[model samples]
Target: MSIAPARIDEQTIRALPKAEVHVHLEGTFSLIDLLTLAKENGVALPGPAATLFDISTHTDFETPEVTTGGGTGTGSAGLSGFLRFLDWQCGLVRTPEQAARVAYAFAARQSASGVRYSDVIVNPTHWNAWRGRDLALMDALSAGFDEAEQDGLCRVGIAYSLLRGQTAADAEDAVARLADASLRRVVALSVDGDEKTTGRTGEKFQNAFAIAASAGLHRTVHAGESSGPEGVWDAIDLLQAERIDHGVRAIEDDALIARLIADGVSLGVCPRSNITLGIYDGWASHPLPRLLAAGVRVTLNTDDPAPMGTSLEADWAVAADQFGFSHDDMVGFARRSLEASFADDDLKRDLLTELEAVVTASTAAEVTA
Candidate 1:
């Protein structure tokens, strides 16, 4: 009789070294944190703190447009709902101290989840309360990350998020914000938001991205999520994004898949995020397996951990269980994450070494058993 393989569990998944490159800092806040911040800032709540904190209801992201100020149109319907919730959370932090606290908490939480290093995406424009104080806000957020590093929780880097659907002039102003010396912690410039609502692509912000490239900032743009493979191509050809967020849709086009493989571009794939937003019906239907088999560099991430109800480890466990990944395959996923990160060489080297040793020890023990 043939023997069945052993199962992978959460414990094993959590023990592996991992990194999250596509997560948004604004979405990391816990419900309790949101309540506290709202109370501290005197921001009025839309409903009972307890009721709004219930993310169980918020899981249905396919609902109609719920907010007025953000954007409009068809494709924007899905992600715009999440963005409105994000705007509410961002609006709660009215002070520099609050921003610092939120940042510190985010690092600590991810560290506890087994993330050794993270590139957190922060879009200043989302924080309505911090208008005209972006420099101070960046400095405060950096201070929080610095304190977390000093305590050996997790090393964190910032990726300034550029909102989509803005005018060329607005894009120029967005790039100018990163020129501040106090925002030295920023290592990359990223674009996100509803591609469908904006009815635009990477070409719209090429000049702004060119400025970021001139300033030595790495690029990662969201594409092929709500739109299609054309968005991914525009990001690669026009913005020259080093990494593409949610590029799983590239599987739809064979030529695009060839280009992604040839160029070694990494895709930050969030399986749960896709399912939750109605992009894919469920985990088994996700294109992760095809993307991997096609030789494209892919890494699992929680686009918004707290709100999306996922973590790096949870994503790994799901991948292992759903896709039949072995222990070695899981390790490869972790390794791919570090390789795809925008972290400095020194930090990446250290994290990769630590990851390799952990995987070796664990696999050896499994063999001995």
Candidate 2:
């Protein structure tokens, strides 16, 4: 008789070892943080801070009109409205100290979900205050996360994002700026923003990605989220992304799916966000299961946890419940997350060791029973 691995239940999710690779700093602010920052910054509010992101209860994202004026996130549905909210929310952090607070909060929040490390993407275009002082902004964030490290919580790596519509010159400038030694926490160069609205921009930033590759920085591109399979192809071909964010749409093309597996490019998938933003009708229709079935290297993430109202562990549970993910599947996804992250080799090894301990303990317990 063959012995099975320890069974994974919902509670096991909290004990699972994982890392988050696609979370955005702008959209991860907690409601309490938003309230505190609004009070400290004297930002004008449309209503009470408690109900700021509670404006919508629906899940369809058919609207093309961008949210305008003082509307509290959810004025319109889909990616455009979410981008506008990110702009408004990020603007609340007018000082370096506030940015530090946001970074610290990231460690604390991910810790609760048992995430060992997170590679956070922060698009500079969303901020107005630190428009010219890029290094200073990162310095502040690094300081905050460093403080959290003392507590032994989740470690963080910063990835600066280039908005899709930005010119190639802007991409060049971003890569050049990121190369500075003072920006200590930056590990990867990323491209974010809505691909549908910005259209095809892989060619525009191709040179910048090439520069980043030479400079020893990792490349992550946001593709197949708002756009289709063609966008994903550009990421793999032109930009040569090490990982693709929100790549659910890659399922639309069979060749694209094969390419992702052949090229060993991981996709950071956010199932809850996809449904909440109406990217799909519901969880059943999500291509995540299909992608996994096709042997794609996919990892679950909370793209914007606070804004989308989901957590890393919660996403795992949902996947387990909806997709019939077994003990091995969840464990394998956790392993994939660690392998796919930009974390240093030492940290990755240490975390992987801890993961094995969790598994071994569970196995021993089962044997004793």
- For model 2, residues 1-369, the per-residue Cα lDDT tens digits are 978544455578879888999888887888888778878977765445666776343232222232221101122354444665666677788787898888999999999888999999977777767777777888889989998888888999998887776789977987887775636798898887666556788999999999888888999988887678898999989997999988889999999999999999999998887778677889999999899999999999888878767788888888888887887788888899999999999999988898889988977997999
Clashing pairs in 1: none
TM-scores, all candidates, are 0.92, 0.91
Root mean square deviation (Cα) for candidate 2: 4.5
Model 1 TM-score, all chains together: 0.92
**Any runs in candidate 1 off by more than 4 Å, and if so which?**
53-78, 180-182
- Steric clashes per prediction: 0, 0
lDDT per residue (tens digit) for residues 330-364 in model 1: 78888998999999999999999999899878769
Q: Name the best candidate (by lDDT).
A: 2
Report how far off residue 232 is in candidate 2 (Å): 1.0
